[model samples]
Target chain A: MPEDFEVNPWDVKGKVDYDKLIERFGTQRITRDLKERFESVVGELHPMLRREVFFSHRDLDLILNDYVSGKGFFLYTGRGPSKEMHIGHLIPFIFTKWLQDKFRVNLYIEVTDDEKFMQKNELDLEETRKWAYSNIQDIAAVGFDPDRTFIFTDIEYVRNMYPLAVRVAKKLTFSEVRATFGFTESTNVGMLFYPSLQIVPTMFERRRCLIPAGIDQDPYWRLQRDIAESLGFYKVAAIHSKFMPPLTGTEGKMSASQPETAIYLTDDPKTVRLKVNRYAFSGGQPTVELHRKLGGNPEIDVPFQWLYYFFEPNDQVITAIERDYRSGKLLTGELKEILIEKINEFLERHRERKEASKDMIEVYMRRGKLATVMWETVHGLSV
Target chain B: MPEDFEVNPWDVKGKVDYDKLIERFGTQRITRDLKERFESVVGELHPMLRREVFFSHRDLDLILNDYVSGKGFFLYTGRGPSKEMHIGHLIPFIFTKWLQDKFRVNLYIEVTDDEKFMQKNELDLEETRKWAYSNIQDIAAVGFDPDRTFIFTDIEYVRNMYPLAVRVAKKLTFSEVRATFGFTESTNVGMLFYPSLQIVPTMFERRRCLIPAGIDQDPYWRLQRDIAESLGFYKVAAIHSKFMPPLTGTEGKMSASQPETAIYLTDDPKTVRLKVNRYAFSGGQPTVELHRKLGGNPEIDVPFQWLYYFFEPNDQVITAIERDYRSGKLLTGELKEILIEKINEFLERHRERKEASKDMIEVYMRRGKLATVMWETVHGLSV
Candidate 1:
């Protein structure tokens, strides 16, 4: 049996990988340029499309078909503030921003502060709310237009949206929530109703909202979309992304808990280089001659995978590096230098775009909530 | 055992010596001369007392003690509104009106629409609301001042006057409500919360209201008072009247379903006369010889007991009839004739009051509500 089979699910860094997953599920990768098709399906594409990490979607084509027939749909994604935000938190926002900018779709972002509180007790409600604000700022930094996007903090919205929320809560039973969440008999009422909070935003209107999430949460979104139809809600489309893996290992994605596991946007070139050299998981032959025979397993190497995720300008460089490393031309240290260079250049661009970062982000969030709040108020919920 | 030992509790027509009731319950039968003393305890004896139907009371001395010491309490009673108002509904108002006039105390008349709806499903909510207004008019016709009285409909007041109802609902489990109300799993949620609704209005504001009901409902009130302490509500005071058996053979207190069981204030003189002659239970034997031999069994005879409840005009006349009946001189027909005459006069007076009724009653109801709405609005729940 492969040593890889011994990894426990929870002990993995933050999330699991896609290719390994694709192999596990026996699914093919979506390769080739689909932007023109997506534009016809959705409307437009954001600039981030130079790399297609948001590579899979359900119902996008159908909604695009509907839109071409002069129909329109809104956009929705959830940010569960259970932990501090990392750059990975931006993945859904990144796509959602693109969807919003290109299609002019109304956007709804749910800040699930209450869900975070029930999930972990050490975080008080107020601090968790701060986490929500921090996370929204991060999402806003990804460039969702303020006028079209809405950000809802669940606590404030729930008080004003009691009638609609109660309607949803009543239709869902205690046992159903328990079965769905794997909750025990001791689970509190708040926990029992938390999933209904997510369901609420989707049922906001008889229209369109796409949920972009990691594949693991596909099970939950699938349940939500099914329940929505039964409760007379517009079906929610799900856009699934590959898990962004941690620097410490390719066993899984980076998590906020371990600073070394994540190559944070704030990391300097020295830190990024040290982090990759010291902690990035890799496999090589015991000697250079033997390494030449083994070749680099790009699939298992975290740095190579990150280089693929972020190193947009030089696919040819990575491809040549892949060739050289596999045939034992370039060594591990040489591969690390190229990855460090790629990340530094990426951060430098991010820094350049970080002009008026805090102020601009704050303004966007405030303006975004106005549109969101206004729409929510009409859809039987208050912001 | 004496013949009285076999008294049929349901029979009301012949006679009942309430002197026996006062003796059995250890309550004092207050005379008209103790007008000042009666005024002190249950509050001022109403002009309805100038007529005498509300002839006796419990803890009169104690209540009088409290009132005389400058300590004040309020008047409280409520209607179930299970059916239309009858002349019978005027008992509380007549007594309450007297108390209001004498002691100058505050009055709270609760119209229990929530309890009625919870108990009976066939009853229309809107219809019960109409019935509440009609019942309130009848209560006002008894002549209460606008400033001194508060009448709240439970459906509205349960939502407005007390957060205590919510607190109580939280404390109760389904099983607890089931045991208390004999409810099953099929019982609806609103029905399950009925007891809490009743208890809240009883102690609406620091025992600001005192309940006036028949003795049989003592169990419900006692239970409410028990639960109130746990909910942090002030202990409510309850004044229970002896049950007045229905006219169905005069064996029990009047029930709405049985046509012959009650005296409707709307009853024409002919209907009153026929009901008195045919249905008021008789204690006289089947034969005049037997009646003369045994004398009228005052215990089981319904009309004489009713006289104790209603025929308050001249005790000398009442005492004279009692003596003549026990002495076997007063025929059962003669006794029923006297009751029919007395009831006709009483009904006439109420009818006249009903005739003079005007829109001014709403003014009193509104004034009563305004006096208390500000205080009850503390939880920000009032309309």
Candidate 2:
């Protein structure tokens, strides 16, 4: 069977070509000038931005213009509770936390439990809700400020979200949704309406919103941007990130379904070390003699890519590791060992924070100041 | 051009054939046996059941069986609130009130403000919500028990409905809805997901539920029954009513869009008289002498149908009216005058109750014991 390798809100397949996708999706590239402008505002870029992993954008220049003029923007992102969070699932949340801290902005995280239930045939509503609560542990562990952040599941916070969602759904027709997401007759009606819920956060505040997510989700914002201004709001801005490569190779992103190809946040250090040693795809020669003679390719190495993407943030250290690996001085096992150590160290603290978050989840889950302000703005309720 | 009489939840056109619709829709007839069974339980039959205004049903025998066995069922009905409520819109509400009073069961009234907004191209969310509140006034005038009845609009009560709606949406695909409603690509996503919300009231209580609505709404219950037992609930029972004939004729039902043909509850007695005198479809001779010699067809007279359906509940009086009209002793003007008197008297009381209901709406509007009970049942919350 032939695979289309298409990327949309529902499906992700094939080895995605990022530059081609930027063109196909009609999003603007993250130019060098924009990077400098972003760095100036944040003091320093997060590693994801610095490494070009946060690659493409839509209306980002306008958001930056507003931010530069002292008109701040809020952050919006989400998770679908289909399964446990793997290491790859943390990419956007980690970057969002950094963005939140650097910009001192409010962050709204939507848990799309309803979407997961509608999309997955095997999962029940109760199961999706369970995963949602568990995933909140991982999300809270990323350490967003309780005062400036609000986290809510769709089922629980529908009272706050549904009014805006209905407004968005009113303007969208089935043809537009099908054209945007390739939705066919088999798609559930809730999944068709799910984008309306996703788009609600973008219009939550009357001010600008900057959504940070993988490029796979760009189609949603495209639909949102098309209908936003007519609904008496600004078009949503987005900072698109590249998928974190799976452990086996760069064919696709890490997946929770393929447990062997990803490391879970709850995995013990020993398990992490074992998985990294046994499954991490190497770019070295078959023989040590040839590797030493011809040198290895760090460009295609999964361990090196993971380190560069998130784990090893120091530029000098990363440059040294890349150069050493290219010269065959850093063998595959040595590199895997280093990558495993970095990942385990990060996970150790994350695990502790996640454990603590179980008791404190309600603090972050409350309908706080931002929700009240947005509700008032949308409903025109006099305070 | 030839016209096809089409009827569904969203659109109704041409001259509907009630008997053919019951056959095409695959619902059971409200036979003499069922009518006797109903009257036995209620001790006196509502005019609708006795006159066969509510002409068809599905699984009503099961509900009656449960009622006989002491396992009571609730009543579910709704209004779209697209416009002002005309006298014709009172068919289901008046009958539902009778069911609630006789059966002593809970009644859940869904005011589908979201549905109205999604289906009407010209109406906005705020306008639909305004109509919903206004229509609630009319619904309240039907005199449902405040303690036993709960009325909710889709937008305001989404928190209570969304979880069950998600479950229903999970089991329903676009194909099923399209096949059921003949929905094209032009349908909005909200319109597609609305059946899920419509079906939630059936599962509000763990016991059986009987939905009293027009036959136009049978498609929604058909979808609901197909998936009900799989969700661990009984199939919903529905008693379907015929459309109240438009004042102009049997061409369509009364519509707020056509003010000349509809007697709105808010219409003044003089306007009601003017509308009936000028626009009510008449089956009489051109001259009084010709009518006295030839006689009139009481079966096709709009005024006679309205009185027989609801206003004039006396069987002997209705039979005398038919006999007099057929014998040319009663003219169309006299029949219409009698209908006008009956309608004005009914509206006078309805308006008084509606006016009084404005101050008392909060009692019924509050999320009372049943809402909390259902919420706890769904979420397993201890509060």
Candidate 3:
């Protein structure tokens, strides 16, 4: 039998079976016991966890155990800056910020400007750096704890990270990375060496590292796990989230190359309204009579899925919308209107915070308490 | 037909044919015309150039043209820090210092601590860094112009070079480095990425860059030459030297692994005398009675070769030694004693300078005029 879906760090195709991904990736599913453990510790679960959107994990149980035992863990997540970020790009950052706010631990946000430039033939360093600044602002607008979060680009912080990166790089052979990353002879050496830079922050603190990222990024952590203990650091723990479905249909994730399949953060209210009305995938019947008689299917509807995934976080409101849409009491146009309004409201607040937090970018990047300590120290394994 | 010699950046074996190497590596021989051009412009020639010790070149004539036209060139060379500094290791730096003194151009000395650590499985970054400091001191003792020389270790200076390294790395794939460096799938990713860092300093200046190094390092410059003009920089010029033969024989270069085959900078006078008598290969007859009748072969003697290559700089004195040894008037033991005395004198002077130049390492690495500018500037091709 041929598999219908494919997912990796660089590309995703078809509608993914999240359960199958957990098995394929050799990660544990977030069972009821783990969710209850999480709720007990945090006082409440984030909607993503409650809905099982953040569904799989590796070494997550040990991270919670360490936290409870008075030894803390840190958070690490990154973005590759190649183009303007879309709504899909904000998922990991938002969750990471929530984790930091609740745990009061350090958070590291790496902007991989070098990797992005090296990976693409047409993208130059300057262009990637420009996108890095723009993407960092949007991430800063997500309101992470400024004192606990340290955001850095690979090109800028390489001086501090290189010692540890080479240590990690030495442990990995071309054969190992080629097997893990699907790299070929044609892969640029910068991209080949980039996994070491990504692994550096996981060992930044002696305590366990907890990464909240898309399941596509799990391969890097897998490579990290293979060498972390040998290098005298704990294996990194990770919480893997499902991909945010594109607007056209719930097949592949949103891509920056196809503007119609994704909504940019800079999209205005009118543009969001137009896109939702024009391109949002609907599960309603062709005619009003048919839709009224047959009702709609909320399972495959893109707008309903988006609401459930991110925009509408209210449980009762989402449940009510789902119920009405399934009963034919709410039409496709009405559902898209609700999504458009929610999206515009989110973007408006995000844009406001982005403008207001201009000064805080520096605080998050360098002047914050965590950032200060990080800049003063060069991270590496102890002899 | 089996070739008896092998030479690469990492290894050299058997008796090398210099002319054959020129043909095999596709480099030009230092012709009489080029030698005259060098002597005319510099007002005199260094002994190494005059005797063809530094025998091959890539673009010597162009460097001269650039200098004569007021478009000057700079010098670059490097050392991989994995062991104590030895006499064979200092061959290029000694010659390079002479070039810098004559031409009065800036020189960049890269201590490749990262590459050394990555290349050897048993070596660690800290060990390489320790050797880097010691090796750099020996290099500093060569007395480069403090204001025009910048010596740096790759581990310490990666931040300043990474942006440019990635730019160079982006143009090269795994296949390219694999072919150039004989990299296998088992090679570490750090070693694969290191060629980029080695190529970075060649583009540090917009003016033509000249490298004076052993011919073994030509492959890296070959890769650099291929991409440099496209990056809007001049193709680097190089003058390549033949390796100093080991004390055991005139076959392979000196080996640090076999301590008896090489004279270390730290070897005492007593150790030098002992090593010379014990390990120096002789070309005279076994018995003294027969030796007086059978002449020694100066061409195959290690002591005579060493003196001709480096230690005995005076032309008439070396010629007398060669003639007397060839005519059997000078015995093998007598020749060995002469080499031992000359080596002790050289080592004594080098040790004195190494001790007195403790303060100068900082000047060459950070505080000197060129060092200060290099520390402030991040080298990259202009956009």
Q: Which candidate leads in DockQ?
A: 3
The weakest ten consecutive residues by lDDT in model 2 chain A span A374-383
Task: Please report, as a residue range, the 10-residue window in candidate 3 chain A with the lowest summed lDDT.
Answer: A374-383
- The candidate scoring highest on TM-score is 3
Residue-wise lDDT of candidate 2 within A181-221, one digit each (tens)? 98888888988888898898888777899999999999999
Which stretches of model 2 miss by more than 4 angstroms? A1-4, A367-383, B1-3, B367-383
Give TM-scores of chain A for all candidates. Answer: 0.81, 0.95, 0.98
Top candidate, metric lDDT: 3
Rank by TM-score, descending? Answer: 3, 2, 1
In model 1, what lDDT does residue B123 have? 60
Q: Which residue pairs of candidate 2 clash?
A: none
Q: All predictions: root-mean-square deviation over Cα? A: 11.1, 2.2, 1.3
Model 1, C-alpha of A379: deviation from truth (Å): 3.5
lDDT of 2 by residue, B1-383 (tens): 46469888766788888788888899999999889987887698888888999989998889989998998888889999999999988868988988888788998889998888888889877788889989999988888887787788888788777888888887888899999989878888888888899888888877999999989999989998999899888889999998888899877677789898789999999999999999999888889999999999877788988988888999899999999999999998999999999999999999998988875466566755664454345421112
Residue A329's C-alpha lDDT in candidate 1?
A: 74
DockQ values per model: 0.05, 0.62, 0.69
Runs in model 3 with CA error above 4 Å? A1-3, A381-383, B1-3, B381-383
